[model samples]
Target chain A: MNIAEALKRTFPMKDLSQGKAASIFASVKSKMPAFVLKNNAPYRAVMTMDDYEILEWAHEYRLTHPGVVWAESLKWESEEDKDDHIALFNRLEATKNSGSLGGKELLDAVQKLAAQQ
Target chain B: MAEVDGRILDAVGRFAELSFLRMKPEALLADLQCLFELYGDSFEEVMDGVVKALKDIAQDRVTVSPMKYDLSQYSCYHFQSVVEQGQPADMRSLFKRAEDGTLEVEMIGNRFFPADIYTRATERIEYYLGDIGNMSE
Candidate 1:
């Protein structure tokens, strides 16, 4: 069932005062059960402990692995250095002829080379 | 004008400290509105009391100001707390005069959470308050 429909069946929105809301949230959390509120209200969703843990893990994973598009948008301290970084990447591509490497792999290789010098 | 009592002052001080430390926006706003309800007809007195109480507790760590907007018929109080080891945070309370001269107070902004947490908390508070408002209508 949809969240709204599920919530309506479990908790009625009309009787949800601020105090009642807090109490309901605490109860739902302690009970470790998923509940849908009669509305799409924020801070009112209560999920199972496992579901919450999964959500947190997914968030951490996204932060660590932000994908290629986000990694490409990262900035350097200086505009000149940013251009130098791009130039260095071009040189690396020519020298290694490693065009097949992904963006992160290429970045790692560039960083490794810079560390050596 | 009735002078604000010490008990009320103490309560306001505690509320400010909590708002500056760990209280979420919704809870903070709810507590602040409760204070207004408790103070009854002494809106200005309560505002002054809270400012003084915050200043006393914050001391050199913060600055408190009372501002009035003549065009909007609103009175606002602001406090910016400086963190010795991290980024500072600000809290603003606005009292808008209603049709019958009763002021409706709303406490908004962040005083403790980091930028990212504050942004997320604000979004949630806005959505929750919007839902509540809609339901009332």
Candidate 2:
């Protein structure tokens, strides 16, 4: 909501002449979230994928978890590329009681075996 | 003496091989609504006004909003989910994607699942064979 600082870099509508507009885009497309102003008011804004994704995820996480404050939940919105936990889930899911082990004993056995390795 | 259920483990392994993930328009649009609302009062006056100005293209994009983000992660809560497919259970390696993409769910994820069922299944298998050091760690 405190976007006053963000509004520092703005392109007035009349300034968007063809040649200048192309160069302006080239200058800010990568580092965007630039505002386009017309009649002294912002009309449209340009945003990069990174900026957009962060805002998108943050908004979604905020709405889904109402109790979580914006800044606190923003930390959890970054995308992680690893899936080791899921792999572990698979290995654990693939279990079947072929021998004598069935409940907690089985979990303990796996834990012990995992520990030794 | 409280142990795991053998049937549950068997079912999980068998079901892991299947893939049925679908997204409906309602759920998809709701996600977008949440995003637009980030601007608060400006959502309707400023943002929505832009859409109104470019209503044709904007409306079309809004219709296919679900396709915009081909999600890599899926935390299934319903029988037929839509954002993306649920993860496939393949315990072959330690770092491969869930059949393709990474799916990192929370400790309590999905309604159909009783949370971490895969872990239980793997434990049962290990308990039976009393082995798997080479495969899992």
Candidate 3:
């Protein structure tokens, strides 16, 4: 499939509507199929090396930004602390699904506590 | 001097055997990489040479082959199947028919039974009564 066709088929993003010819050119360069789906669900579309390189550059930029939690989350403060954090998240998820508490209240409490951290 | 050389060869052979028996997956990968770098060969070719080298170094060395996965084909043939064990039937003859392999089956009546007969009987019984063990639940 062509890039335009693939983008139309897969991506829900509205910004990709840059006319058909340009999309076809992009698809030709990426060597990725014009469409990609796994088990009838959209998986990933192929991209040109240039497009991938640009994405990699953007990823690096985000990783280097102090405000982004991607880098911070990868760091392990302590195994015990990591275990405790996971346990807390699991407990919160269980509480949310239990139907005994207000979801907005629980979420607001989590957001407030997370904001402090 | 020849006797001494033979003794040295024997010791070398023993050490090589021990080393081969003890080789791990990671070390084999490293060795294969080195062979590829030095020989300017394809990975499989390098891996084959490395296997030979390992065998020469020690007897019975284990090797882990690389795996390749490609996910591009969209129209490939696929299949689905499910195996289910049927509840025990109330009749021994149906069970015996199932055990004889005349039918694709389920267990019923303390014996094996073909699926068609079991299903027909089950539907008939369920139609008469709301369910098989209606009041039990």
Give DockQ: model 1. 0.01
Docking class of 2: incorrect
Best by DockQ: 2
Q: Model 1: clashing residue pairs?
A: A7-A36
Q: Give candidate 3's root-mean-square deviation (CA, Å).
A: 30.2
lDDT of 2 at B26: 19
DockQ (Cα-based) per candidate? 0.01, 0.02, 0.01
lDDT for each residue of candidate 1 in A6-102, tens digit (9 for 90 to 100): 5543655544664576665665543354354555553355666877888788767644433221223323345654454344334333333332122
Worst 10 residues of 1 chain A by lDDT: A66-75
Instruction: Write down the TM-score of every candidate.
Output: 0.22, 0.25, 0.18
Residue-by-residue lDDT tens digits, candidate 1, B1-137: 12324443344344443322222222333334335444456544555545553444333344434433221332444543332355333445444334643323434333332222233233333333333123223
lDDT of each: 0.40, 0.34, 0.31
Instruction: Fill in the DockQ of model 3.
Output: 0.01
Query: Residue A42: error of model 3 in Å?
Result: 1.6
